[model samples]
Target: MTAPTPGTDGPSIRPRTAQHYSVAPVLDTPEGYVAPGMPGVPVTGYDPGTPTPHRRKPRRRTGLALLLAPLAALLAGLAYGCAPLRAADSLGWLTIAQAGLVSLPLGLLGGRNRLLPPLGALLSAGALLLGQLIQQLRLVHADTTTPRTLLQHTLTSWRADLRPLDLAFYAIALTGGFLLTRRTATRT
Candidate 1:
C-alpha cells in the first residue's frame, strides 16, 4: 500500500458530537423573580403584578339570630321561674345555679344579634318577677288573710325575701350572655 493520494479515501475520521445545555430565565426585582401567567403562586417578596387571592363575604345571620333570641330568652325565663318551685326550700341555691346555667344557652344562641343581650336580660328579670308574684298569690290563697293585706306584705317584704346571692346569679347570667354574644358577633 503506497501513500494514498489527497483525493482518495484511506481511513475515515468522524467528528465528535456537539454538547447541549439549558438554563431557566432569571429576573432581578424587589418582588423577586416570578414566572408570569402562573395562578396562585406566591412570589418571594411583594409583587404588584401578582393577582390577589379572592376573599369570600361573611354570611349575614343577624335577622335569624334576632328572631331566635326572644324564644331562647323565654325558655331561660321559664327555667328560672320554675326551678325554685320544683326544688326544696333548703336547696334554693341549687335553683339559682340552675337558672344561671340555663340562661347561658340563651345568650350563646341569641347573643349574635345586638339587641338580644338586653332582651334576654329583660326576659330573665320578668320571669323572676312573675315567680315572686305567683308565690305571693299562693301564700295569700293558703292563708285566711285578705288579698290586700297579703299583697301589701309581699310588696313591702320583697327585698327581704330575695337573697343577694340570687340577684348576683341573675346578673352574672345577663352579663355573661351579653359579653358572649358581643364577642361572637364581632368575629363574624
Candidate 2:
C-alpha cells in the first residue's frame, strides 16, 4: 500500500450522511385518532376546531384536615385543663405560653392550606371552652359539689378563668402558626 498522508485515515474510515424522513400532514377526523396500545377513549390534542375545557385538580388532605382538626382541639383542651392541676399558681402568664404549645402541632399537622387558620381559631376557642367545662366537672367530682352549684359557679366565673389576655395570646399563636407553616410549605 502507498504511504498514508499526514493525519489521514485508511479507506475503511468514511464520513456519514444524515438520513431524512418525509413529513406527513396530520389529518383531523370526526372521530379522533387514538394512540396505539393506550386503553379507553382517545384523548385529543389542542385544536382550534375543539372547545377547550376548564379542569380543576381534586383537593387532597381534606380527610386529613377533618381528622386532625378535632384531634388538635381535644389536645389543646386537655393541655389547658391539665396545666393548672400540675401547678395551679405556677401557670400564670405561662398559660399564655400554652397557646403556642397548642397551636404549633395544629399548624404543623394541618399544613399551610387556606382552610387551616380559621379552623385553628375555631378549634382553639372550642378547646378553651372544653377546658373550662373539664375544670368545672373535675372540681364538682372531687369536692362533692352540687352539679347545679358548680355549673352556676363556672358560668359566672369562666371569664376570670379564661382571661381576655389569654384569648389574645391564643389568637396571636394561631396567626403565628398559620404564617410559619405557610412559609415552611413554600420553602420546600
Candidate 3:
C-alpha cells in the first residue's frame, strides 16, 4: 500500500495494489443473489425442472416388449428346431442371444423394474415348448393327430427328450435377459 498523499483540502489516500486470489467457483449465495463468476469456468444451462436435449423422456416399455416378445420367441423356437433334439448339448447361442438382445430395448427405453422379465420368460417358455411339440410331431410320429392329442403326447414325452443342458441353457438365457435388461429408476 502507498502512504497517504497531501492534497490541497486534506490528506488523500493513494491507490492500493490489487489483491490476488485463487480462482474458484462460488455456488452458495444469499437469497436472490448470484456470486461473482470466475474466469474460464463454464456455466451450465441445466435446471431442476428443465428437460435436457440429450435426455430422452421416460417411457413405458411393456407395449413394445409385448409386441416383440412373440417374434423373438418364434425366432428362438425356429433355432431350437434346427438343433439336434436327441442329443442337444446347448440351446444354441442364437436363442440366448435373441433373449438377451430382446431385453436390451426394454432396459434402454423404460425406467425401473416391471413385468418385462417374467413376461419375456413366459413367452420364451411357451414358444420353446410348443416348438418341441411340433418338432416331435413332424419327426417322431409323422401321423395326423389332433391338437389336443399332440399336446398330451408332447407333455408325456418331453421329459424323455430333455437334453443334458436344455434346462441350464434356458435358465441362462432367461436369467441373462432379466439381469442384463434391468432399467434404472428415473427421478423425473
Candidate 4:
C-alpha cells in the first residue's frame, strides 16, 4: 500500500512521501549549470548591481554663426568705403558695396562646412583683392578722377565677369551642405 522511490541503481526499499526531502543527482553537481551565486549575471558580462560607462558625441556648427560671417564682411566694406563718403565723397558707398560682396561668399562658406569655412572666407577675400586690382587698373588707364566713379564704372564694365566666381561659390556651398548633412545623420 505504498509507492517505492525511483532509483537508477535499484528500487528504494522505502516509500517516496516518507522521507523529509531529497535532491536529484543532476542538481547536486557544479558541472554544466551555474549555482546562482556566481560572479556576474547569466547573460551580461557585467553585474546588475554595478553601473556601466557612458559615451558622448561631438558638437556640430550653428546656422546663425554661418550667417554672421557675411554680415561682418558687409560691415567691413562699409567701414572702408564710407570713409570718403564721410568726407562728402561718393566713393565710400562703392567701398561699402565691395566689402559687402566679399562678406556674402565668406558667410555662405561658413554655413557649409566647419573644416572648409576658413578656406571659403579666404577665397572670398582673394576675390575682393582681384576686384581692387581691376578698379586700380581702370584709374591708371583712363586717368579716372575718383575711386567711387572708377569703382562704379569697373562694376558696369565687368558685370558678367563675376559669373565664374559665382559658380565656384555655389559649388563649395553645395558640397559643404551635403557633407554636413551626412555627418549629422551618422552621429545620430
Candidate 5:
C-alpha cells in the first residue's frame, strides 16, 4: 500500500509486500526461533524472553596439569626456532617471538597458580637456550662426525653470535613471561 510523503512534494512511498520481495526471509535460526502461543508455548499475554546479557565466554583450558608445563616449554622452544626463519635480524625478532608468541599466550593458557608464573618464566628461558642449541645444531651440516673441523666451527659460531644485548633480551623475555603469567592468573 502507498503512503503520502511527510514533508516534500514527491512520489508517495509504498510499503513492500511479500510479492514484491525477491529474497526469501529467514524462517528459522540455529537456536530454532519460536513464536509465543505456538502449540505448547504459553499463550497468556505473549512475552518475549529477556535477551541474555552479553558476556565473554571463558576460554577452555587444557585439563591435564601434568602435561601443561612441558607442552608450553616445548612449544616456546619451537616458536623461538621459527623466529630465525622469519626475519634476517635475530635480535628483536627472537625477542618478539619468545615474549609475544610463546610466553604471553602459553602463560595465559597455562594453569593459574602462585608457583606457575615463575615456572613458566624459567621454562621459557630454558626453551630459548634450547633454541640456541638448535642454532648450533643447524651449523653442523654433516650428519656424521667431521673430525673436529666442523665441531670447532659450530662452537665458534655459537660463541661469536651471542652478544651482551642478546643476553639482555633474554632477561626481558623471562621477566615478561613471569609478569604476564602472574598478572593474568591472579585475576578472577
Candidate 6:
C-alpha cells in the first residue's frame, strides 16, 4: 500500500479489494478511512476508537513550597546553633545532638524528595525521647531525691517541652499535606 500524502487526511493503507481504489488516498485514520458502519471495513474506513492527536499538558511543581524548604532547614540549623553543646556534661551535649538530629529530617523533607518526611519524624521522636532522658539526668544531678522523684521531675519537664516541638512537626506535616492537595486539585 502506498502511504498517504503528507497533511491531507487520507488512507495510507491500500485495500485488498478493487472497490476502494476509486476513493482518494487521504483517509489515513479509522475515522477517515472507513465510513461509519461499512461492511468488511473498507480500506478507506476511518476507525472511530483512535485517539485524537493532542499536545500534552505541562508538569506542575510546588515552586513556593520548594523555595521554603531551605528556610525550614535553616530554622532547624538555628536550633542546633542555640543548643548548649559546650557544657561540661555529656548529657548536655547529648541533648544538643538529639535536637540537631531531629531537625535534619525537617530540613530534608523541606527539599524535593520522598524519604525526608519519614526520616524527619523518626529523628524528631528519637530526639524528643533523648531530650527527656537528658532532662531526667539533669534532675537527678540537681536533687537529693529518690529515683521515683527524679523520674517524676523528668516526666514533668518532658510534658512541658515536648508538646511545643511535637506541635511544630504537626504543623509541618499539615502544611506539606495542604500544599500537595492544592497542587492536585489545580491539576485536575
Q: Which stretches of candidate 3 lie over 4 Å from their true place?
A: 1-58, 82-87, 90-94, 141-148, 183-188
**Candidate 1 on 1-188: residue-level lDDT in tens?**
46554447754354445655486454466565445668756655788889999877556655565566555555544554455554524433333343343344444444355565565455545555555555545544565477688787767556567787667655755555555445545333
Q: How does each model score on lDDT? A: 0.54, 0.57, 0.60, 0.46, 0.61, 0.47
Worst 10 residues of 6 by lDDT: 179-188
Question: Please, what are the lDDT tens digits per residue for candidate 4 over residues 111-147?
Answer: 3344444443443454344533444344344856787
- The root-mean-square deviation over C-alpha atoms between each candidate and the true structure, in angstroms, is 12.9, 12.0, 9.3, 16.5, 13.1, 17.0
Q: Candidates' TM-scores?
A: 0.46, 0.48, 0.53, 0.31, 0.51, 0.28
Which candidate tops TM-score?
A: 3
Clashes per candidate, residues 3 or more apart or on different chains: 0, 0, 0, 1, 0, 18
The candidate, 1 or 4, that scores higher on TM-score is 1
Q: Which ten residues in a row have the lowest lDDT in candidate 2?
A: 179-188
Model 5 error, position 67 (Å): 2.0
Give the alpha carbon lDDT tens digit for every residue of 83-152 in model 5.
5543524544365455444444444655465666676577667777766656665656555377576667
For residues 1-188, what per-residue lDDT tens digits would candidate 3 score against the true structure? 56556676566666656756697666577776544486654568757798657976567765665666677667667666666767443444444565665565555544455676665555555555655665665564555367777666766676787775667656766766666556322435
- The 10 consecutive residues of candidate 3 with the worst lDDT sum are 179-188
Ranking by TM-score: 3, 5, 2, 1, 4, 6
